[model samples]
Target: MVSKVKIKINDLYKIFGPKGESHVEKVKSGMGKPELLEKHSHVLGLQNINLDIIEGKIQVIMGLSGSGKSTLIRHINRLIEPTAGQIFIDDTDVLAMSDEELMNFRRFKASMVFQKFALLPHRTVLANTIYGLTMQGLEVKEAEERAAHWLKRVGLEGFEDRYPAQLSGGMQQRVGLARALATDADILLMDEAFSALDPLIRSDMQEILLELQEELHKTIVFITHDLDEALRIGDDIAILRDGRLVQQGSSQDIVLNPADDYVGDFIKDINRARVLTLGTLPLKKASTKGIALSNNTSLENAMKALVDAKKDSVIVVKGDKKLGSVSMHDIVHAATRSSETAGEAVTYR
Candidate 1:
């Protein structure tokens, strides 16, 4: 049977240090849990990570440098085996695959783009795009034709002959993206692939990734430290800290109902208007004689209704049917409570 969840991680652990040692020790020390892990020296790259990457949606694993975002993505593709825990891709335990099985899994199922572009410095863009398929024994002509297709798909229609050294950083990254696409894998793993590009190009790349997803519906696991990027590109987000998952939820849910303080602080300054929607707010009975807002409208937009409708209440409508109303007081309350709840979740982490 096809799996409902494209990726599943449960009680996952990755420790760095001596072989057979726990990494949580190092994790504790760094997080000021030092004397706490006094019994061991291993560093916990990931701790009891429990998450589900829904099929065909961009799931951004977000955190700072040491938060283990990269380590986590690598786990999904089995680039680095988890020290302990279970990782499943389409119902198969990735960690249980033999060497050949793993190789086949990677070639046919997972494709990745990296931060450094990972293009052959000496090869032309077209050659680099076809490199992976060529390794799998595809004929030169077939691979070239496929490469040309992705080149056009990624808007690099005419730059196939240029070498990586000859292209702008943005263009080089596109070549890498095209190469990954050419592999025709079921999943795409991107590790800060746009961080090296200038802001303007990064924004363009973000749009490109979204459009690609719309057409292919390939499951995507993207890593990023930028909150804005996470909010913009992720269908769901899994926030990590101290090498452990802090929280996971839809972008709107995370912004509207943060699981902890670390997440709240991470998103505190975010313009709510850009991150929250009516779905984030609580709905009340409508026919009680009060103003209302569309269920699809954002809380920020609903706030406008509360203000412009000149009433402390607004109705919530689902299509033509009246769902409920949110009073001005509830609006302010939800807003503040959500932030505080996030702050509280931070304490847990």
Candidate 2:
């Protein structure tokens, strides 16, 4: 089934300077970032970015410091206007929205989760979660019910009256998430939402988001600098470098076939076995004796399952139907093969 596109970004460009628009031609004509800054005194934020964000899937945009990942997410809600381009949400041109229309769009169509847990420090957990609904003029009773449901859903059932200072970093982040979800908006824009948490808490938050996605499937555009997080949660990923999209694809595609030396170096140390799924491996005839595994099973978990069953291969299934089989040899080869040498054998479907 072809999923509808929830958001479309076309020829997006953002330059940070007084005369940024004047140099768009120069940048398009092969002017490098350093040269553009040195010669024109303009900083390129994004250059000709065209992407389709499918409905009900997580699209992760990642890069190091000075990359335009953060800038790009803001453009969706017109927090930062683009120098040139169009943003379409469900076919409505966001860039074309009037002041009132844009305000409505931000309040009703989209919700943002910030890295710093942008909860009003003065408001309690329940108040923060109901903030959006209240802003939308929902009845007090109705909004409270909605807020309470999401707070409990995010595991903050009793934290309703606690201030942000009283909760741990993880708990504060949960309030931020609950706020976004409470809005019940169709799109969730998470800007480095989990980056500030401790490692274990960060992992737990990722699991929570994925679990909610299974039931809610809001169109999520998650921003991050961590490659592992991107691979772990993104249904599709777009990598940005110096305002340009270096690569975009499934986690397996980028891991097995990096677009350039820069991307290759970025993923060199990633624990691929933990992120690469069985669906990435080539499908093969199933053997009757092996245990069954899901197509989305991680290579690491699949290996553990294989070892536990005393089997060398496992049949991959999606629901009740068998997709193919994967052997222990394939998992090891896929995880160990150098990106330079990766080809058909290691390439997952």
Models 1 onward score TM values of: 0.85, 0.90
Q: What TM-score quantifies how close candidate 2 is to the native fold?
A: 0.90
Q: Write the per-residue lDDT of candidate 2 for residues 1-349, one digit (tens) a residue.
A: 9899999999999999998889988888988888988998888899989999999999999888788999999999989999998999999999889999998888899999999999899988988898999888898789989999999998999889999999999999999999999988999999999999999999999999999999998999999999999998999999998898999999888887899777787788799888788988987887776889999898899999988888999899999998888789988898776666334233211
lDDT top scorer: 2
In model 2, residue pairs whose N, Cα or C atoms come closer than 3 Å (at least 3 residues apart or on different chains), thus clashing, are 280-348
Instruction: Give one digit per residue, the lDDT tens place, for model 1 in 38-72.
Output: 55655567777899988988999999888899998
| Top TM-score prediction, candidate number | 2
Error of 1 at 37 (Å): 7.8
Predicted structure 1: lDDT:
0.82
Q: Which ten residues in a row have the lowest lDDT in candidate 2?
A: 340-349
